[model samples]
Target: MTQKKPTSRRQFLGQTAAIASASLVPFGALSSRVSAQSPNERPRFALIGVGGNGTRTAPVGQQFADLVALCDVDAKHLAHGNGLLCDGKADLYGDYREVLAQDDIDIVQISAPDHWHTKILIEAMLAGKDAYCEKPLTLTIDEGKLIRKVQKQTGRVVQVGTQQRSSMNFFNKALAVIADGRLGKLYKITVGIDAGGWSPEISVADVPEGLDWDRWLGPTPVMPFRYLQDPKKDTDRNYTNGHTHFRWWYEHSGGKLTDWGAHHIDIAMLGIAAAGQNNDPVSVGGSSRHDVEFKDGVPMQDNRYNTAREFDLIVDFADRDVQINIRHDVDNGILFEGERGRIFVNRGKLVGKPIEDVATKPLPKDAIAKVYRDMPIMGNDRDAHWANFTHSIKHRTLPISDVHSHMKMLNVCHLAGISCRLDRTIHWDQTTEQITGDELAASMMSRPYREGYEIEM
Candidate 1:
């Protein structure tokens, strides 16, 4: 990977402003923050692995971004994101390290799977560029702490793609209601994600062309390409495509635990104010029940994903408790049970006691401004999230969904998944962010990185 000297703030913002004004692209209502460059100037960024979510979301990024480069291990994703660049001059690369190596890039939007997140983020910070990495911040607890350390030491702005923090209806409302005691001491939080407890037995097969299979397996142990081929070899669809069912595999994702759990449990933890404090949870407990056996069904116990297909994780948070559960169903949502009454919130729905409770106080006007972070739109708009990132870049301000807060939220997701994986009660020293008793459970916090791919502090 080639490393370019860091670009001066003036030059970076100058390039950003030129692209923003000349593009004249339609912006989401969130775009109201689009033009607010600090007196200093705007920030430019690059997109890493612009596939799936990144591909769909990067266009809206234009409202607040000067897309300078696009990168991916797969040429397809790299070319795709570059095509969305307003300047039509954005450079392209197949390896994200190359994008991070460039000193001119102010930010890197990481939309890779859970396993790839930590490596890309650590490298980007070391390269001096701020980062906008996506959710389930890391694959393990140790990696989360290491990334947190780098963020603090580097002083680089990091906005995890946990967009719920910026959502007015979910995060803002939940935070306010809890703080105001509307939830009346907030007894417990129950977060559930639906999934069918099903997985086909793994089988061997050939690797496809164009993909550097080894690169795709970065930081993860190497395996025969057949280890992940489609269970039903009759089908023409190869399961290892960049966008294949990655969420189901442990090497690429944490299944539902990190998938919806990252989103739902994050909101749940935020409402309870248990995020980021290592001394938070004194004990953790859980169970994971899979419908099939590892040798016959999934090949490797934790390869294509050893994450729980169904499980209940409980965390003791001093004054309160949190129950995180995953099941195979589509009716997903979050429920908060307090002394007063219970509140249920999910995408497109918010219902609770008195029905009027949410509207009654409506986040005091002052709180509204502060909680919404003064963004024009108060929801998870890709454009809005990107707008906040770009705005912060020039203003030298931290975005509301910053790495610290996101990492705090991510800790819960990682903890929940860890609890399920261990399937036993365990003690956690939140302040130290370490497991107290079980060495086996503690060992899973981080995994061995492939050669030349280790993420260092």
Candidate 2:
């Protein structure tokens, strides 16, 4: 894992520019045919995991592409999604591999569970399709590295679902302010990923007819069907409970650490780098309080939610000039504290004197544009994120949420989760990109895949 010194921003940008230039040649050759094609000749899309987030993000892709197919493990979700997309116009499948095998699909929108993300995404890229994957892109640190390697070999466009990167008032503005040094000599950043309390008891129930229970458990260990009764509907038989509660399990997700932390931590890392601080943290130490008892990081209770309920984590950057504290004391948002001023931001609002002062004293005209890698701002945040993905597909360039930077940011999230699980301080060797001197902590970097579901480079 040993590597050379990190590339400077200037060098990185220069390399990106060269790639962009080469990308144009492929599209340029097709420009004549592109002009002849109708405006409706949009890229064809196939969506996998058409549940909660998938349903919400499908329209964004529809705004720029045509939905040609839908795949889901649950028949109820598949039916609902197909109904939303022009009745039965799009093809339907229960297996994602079938959708990937279609040559007509130019893009794959992945909104599956966190555990299934890495396998599906790697397979999609290998299938020669550009992809737009939802956030917390990898389930583990090893998955992140595998993704980077595959993406490098394929040279395909992949955009992660961290939409805040394109937000106008929140992350974009926060980065602009930091880049301008309005928050001078940034010292500490506090991130709060509030708790959602413990979920009610889940009991074993009859597996619904249309659901592929085995396929749904893809890479995770096999277990009996568990369902939570819907309080509102005592008679409903669709069995929609298991889909909603997977987030609280360690096997399926990193809980709030990777759930909300995915959004806030990505922005926090951007702000840290913008303020001339190191993006990679050299060490992480933390303690977390889980709602369920645990032995060797596995929850003792098998039928209830097990992810951490509350946590207080501290991370020291490579330069030691900036420290990040992740906790549950405040509302879910990021608070950047600096020598000159401080500002806090979340989805609802971006506040504090520093942010407010931007009105009387505006940031540089190119600030937001620069944060977006000089790409022109198009519509709203979601639209802009989608626009970057589709535009990159046509132009053959990298999107804003490209694999390289996303992997680096997700690494921090994994480290925080590991530290919390082990209840000890962990040191990271940036050069080698491995945990230093801690065998048990390092071993958690990856997990064993269920025999048939292994991911190969």
Candidate 3:
């Protein structure tokens, strides 16, 4: 069905001033329907992949939005989540497309596997729904560009679930320091993600019962499930039952690159002020170390998580030298190295330079708004990412981590992963958004989807 297109970004902003001028409308009024009508009766939303992140955030969404639907490939997860639905009246579906078909669902929260992100997001926007998708936005480099195009065409308010953007003490302070030149000529950035173990290779086996294996492997190539087996310990175990083991496989995910990189590198992208504004790395290269594997391993249980145990990737930025690395037990955090000084920021701790220096350093009132055009302001207190999304839905404004901006950030991770695989330096074309010189390596940017799952413009 053809959807009613949203007003252009410029047109929507133009109406905002007039609405504020009206004595009846509030300055930050969000609803498009205007006052005189009850704004509480707003849009309905749905949750897809209600297992890990979705299950946790489902109740919170219901408080702000009408949770009318739930979808998941796993029946167990769906049944469990359905029981907790507010008023216990939400519609449940196994297929995501079924939920997307509903006309009343004005918004959707996608917490599906990495491989399914681009497909479901693009289709949802085409069907007239705003999306809140988890980060490490795309599985491949090209997918990033394509997703951006569809988001622009549909004019949807999409928020990539990189909640750091909503934090004042974390992201806002980091952005403030960098843009104000407190870091002074920002020379290098170091990002580290802690996944905590080595990955051993594994052998393939048969598909198990009670699981829609093919459907779970949507858009990814069919491969024998690999199970992990420890030598000298006789017994066997299965690790392919859920999404926990998904990050190690290249079929559906990009190991740590998309997993932890989605978080840590996302911060690096924000700090360097390159998250939304840039695309196409001028150069890419990295090295990785993988675990060893034996032939006689348990079925579908392979030590073969495809992620590298230790990795380092360097992407040549236009002005600065940017780098992302994966280390064991270093924890997930970002470090910004500048000519003047350095600072390290993470979830639990924020330290760098000196307290007196950082405390005294203040960005001018117009600084934040000036560096990022229409970037979300993380008021004094952080932890408002989800609230920002709900507000944007009502306000007809795009969230801070919108798809267009997210695609650019995701490309950095994609290039980092590709570089690790190649283990050598490669040149890139910014305009065409393709790798130069090496045809075989360039082809690796995006793999062909399996039958019935290909995404096209």
Candidate 4:
């Protein structure tokens, strides 16, 4: 890891500087069509960005839909996905646009990097395909706006890949206590998403064979491909910039802010909303520690991972008298604290007196069900999310993890990034979804799209 030790653990400062889609058609000008799929009818699916997540979720999507196409910018990735989902039988392509052109594909399941999700999803919706995108959905706050707008206009059933929403009885059970007011007016949600890793420096190299480097850049600025030899091994096969570690780079991702923050902060908002509390934050401010020095929120180094390795932010939803403290020093998961009691929940278990009391003093029969948004508990984890997506497609209903709700939670994450990058608190207007009075912070909202790859509408 190429990281320098932090000079001070407690530092408060103020400085600011900061900060996809596709389409042949404008969403406003296009006529949308959505046919209700029969309960048993298998919706055809296209798996884009067939890397680790694409391979994982794409096969799961097959449980509810047929894999009609697999797309990736790299040929090896496409082949890897082909090996996983189909026995080299499904049609494969290097460009996602080609997958959207296939009229038979009904659902485009995206497991792409955060940077590519918006562009692929907007294009898929415009091409008349429902989508299931990976969590943390957007690379920036404005991307969320674009996605929500296009989704509303196209009437597409877009499900974000936030599986924790249905992780067995863990979150649902924990959230039920809050919704039932058993926590006695919860005041804070502390989400500990661990921390980001300081990456070893990577060296620039020529693009590898079978990769459409230009197309892969898509809306991102074109940059030289970078690769690093695995320190523990003697191979340069793993690219620090592309297939595996893009999340660590700020240009391609929001770092850990949007990575794990996408998952934890989401559940925090769900608990807030389920408890009938306002979920939008009024202001966001915090301190963060990064290996690379930042100038006006921009990282100084380009060859190594630059995201925050440690951070603590306060997302104050003043209207509800609640605050979310997102930090790296605590255990990974969410903690709900209030006057009466507190409970902790993660993939492992839901703990605390509230959870234990549920055995003797059981919550209402519909308590956890309500947390499930009244949707019947499907399977578990990713399977449950996929099931819900298919059910919503058939029933013309919203999946549990809808884009609007996801973006709502994601806003907190992006704001945290703003505060971390700038080293100061930024006020937020929940209604307009704007960072008020900070030109540098506001500039972080949307990024420049490369020419010939700009998003339409």
Top TM-score hit: 4
C-alpha lDDT values of all predictions: 0.64, 0.81, 0.66, 0.80
Candidate 1 residues 146-212, lDDT tens each? 7767666555667777676666655566566666667765666777787623445445556556567
Give me the candidate number with maximum lDDT. 2
Better candidate by lDDT, 1 or 2: 2
Query: For model 4, what is the error of residue 254's alpha carbon versus the real structure, in angstroms, after optimal superposition?
Result: 0.8
lDDT of 2 by residue, 1-457 (tens): 1112344545534544444344433322422222234667877889999988998998988999888889899888888898886376678878787776666777899999889999889877766678999988988898898888767766677899999988977788888899999999789999988973476667888888888888888898887888766677768533222585677787888888899888888888899988988878798887888777776666788877778788889988886888889897787899999989999998888888988898899889999888889976877688889988877776767788888898888888889888877778889987788999999889989998888777633
Q: For all the candidates, what are their Cα RMSDs to the real structure? A: 7.8, 8.8, 8.4, 9.9
Candidate 4: residue pairs that collide: 19-444, 21-119
Q: Residue-wise lDDT of candidate 3 within 112-147, one digit each (tens)?
A: 888889988877766667788887678888888877
The TM-score obtained by model 2 is 0.89
**How high a TM-score does candidate 4 get?**
0.90
Ranked candidates (lDDT, high to low): 2, 4, 3, 1
- Look at candidate 3 and tell me the lDDT of residue 221: 75
At residue 31, what lDDT does model 1 achieve?
Answer: 22
Candidate 4 local distance difference test against the native: 0.80
- Model 2 stretches astray by more than 4 angstroms: 1-40, 230-241
Model 4: per-residue Cα lDDT over 150-206, one tens digit each: 787666788999898878678877787888888887789899998886777789987
